[model samples]
Target: MQFDAILKQKDEIIQQLQSQINPLKNLVEQLLAEVKLLREQNAALLELIKEKDKRIQKLELVEHQYHQLTKLVYGRSSEKTSTALPGQLSLGIDAELVEACNINDGQKIESYTKIKSEKKKHPGRNEIPAHLERKYIDIHPENLPADARTLRYNRNRTIGI
Candidate 1:
């Protein structure tokens, strides 16, 4: 009877542990499912970001190409070219119209005279205006000797006069 009681007590303890372990196992399985779902969503989002980055790079490349093309088309011209051959003119008119107006190789064209200008010749001295007042001054020195004689004076005008 004593051995039976010991065996029964061990069986009851094992039953209680089994009952507790079943609910814990179910909780662990549920948590593992949630983790797997989160990982899948994260991977999908990463793939979407990679695709968007590749598209952005392609758009940037296209924009750069367009910019280069516009610069080539609309930018300032170099205007550099080989010199044209002598007597080989480009009249820009139609060939038929040019042929109709072409001059003969041996015929001489009429010449035109250009008007020319000539500098005016210097006129001789101008007469003084009759309205100007004339004043004369005697330049005789006060300290001259008693025998000093008078001489003809020069007739000159100052700018103020």
Candidate 2:
């Protein structure tokens, strides 16, 4: 009879544990479904962000091309040459203006030119300095009548004299 009572208490403990396990299992399934929905929403937001970035890049490229075209149309370049001479107005070569104004044959157009003469100036030789004076030394040979006579004078003796 005690063995039978012990078996009945064990059966009650197992039933309580199974009742708690059923509620925990339901909570786990609900959490898993919520996680799946959030992942789908995150992927859609990432795709939207990528599309916006592509549109911003395209607009920036178009803006850069517009600025380049504006600079090309308005910037100064060496290709444009002036056609007006001196004493005449600096009018650019516009087809409409050139066609409207024609040179009259009876109009008196007078121009004068002056001749220029260049004078050449020669720089003369430099003069000697006032502080420096010239000293003339008379070198008379002692043996004057030899066919080819050579003289060896000491520099110290000449400088002292």
Candidate 3:
């Protein structure tokens, strides 16, 4: 009777161990499958990095070609040459207009010019008007009727020092 009881206890313990072993094996298999999936993702990421490198190289080559073309088309010299002379307009000057004109003491001409230049460098979203486009040439003394007469008289009166 004592030998039979000992044999029964040993058999019950073996059965319990077998039941736990199967679940542990299943957990190890799941972990192995996850590791394989992670390896595949790492391989795909490496491939993507290589493709991005190739694209960057191609863009750099394109930029180099564009610079070469620009240099070839535009000469290195700063001076611009034209075959024909620019058209000139002759206006009769009146000395009386210069005698009557009054000069402004508070004119901020320099600041106005700087502001306009800055605007050109960083233009607004709206398109520029034709009047503003012509402002640079328009402000010249030669373009103003009264100022042109005064400048012409002064230019002719001044002797070479």
- Candidate 1, pairs of clashing residues: none
TM-score versus the correct structure, for each prediction: 0.39, 0.41, 0.39
10-101 per-residue lDDT for model 1 (tens digits): 99999999999989999999999999999999999999998897678667778976876676677655522322447888757553464456
* Candidate 3 ranges beyond 4 A from true positions: 1-13, 75-161
Largest TM-score belongs to which candidate? 2
Question: Which residue pairs does candidate 3 place in steric collision?
Answer: none
lDDT of 2 by residue, 1-161 (tens): 99999999999999999999989999999999999999999999999998897678667778976776666666555322332347887545554454457777347869889988887778788898889976657587676666765555564455322
lDDT of 3 by residue, 1-161 (tens): 99999999999999999999999999999999999999999999999998897678667778976776676568464322322236754454444454345676446655444444334565549866667633222233435565343322233456332
Candidate 2 segments whose C-alpha is farther than 4 A from its true place:
1-9, 78-161
Superposed by TM-score, candidate 3 places the C-alpha of residue 111 at a distance from the truth, in angstroms, of: 56
* Model 1: lDDT to the true structure: 0.77
Model 1: residue 148 alpha-carbon error in angstroms: 60
Alpha-carbon lDDT, every model: 0.77, 0.74, 0.67
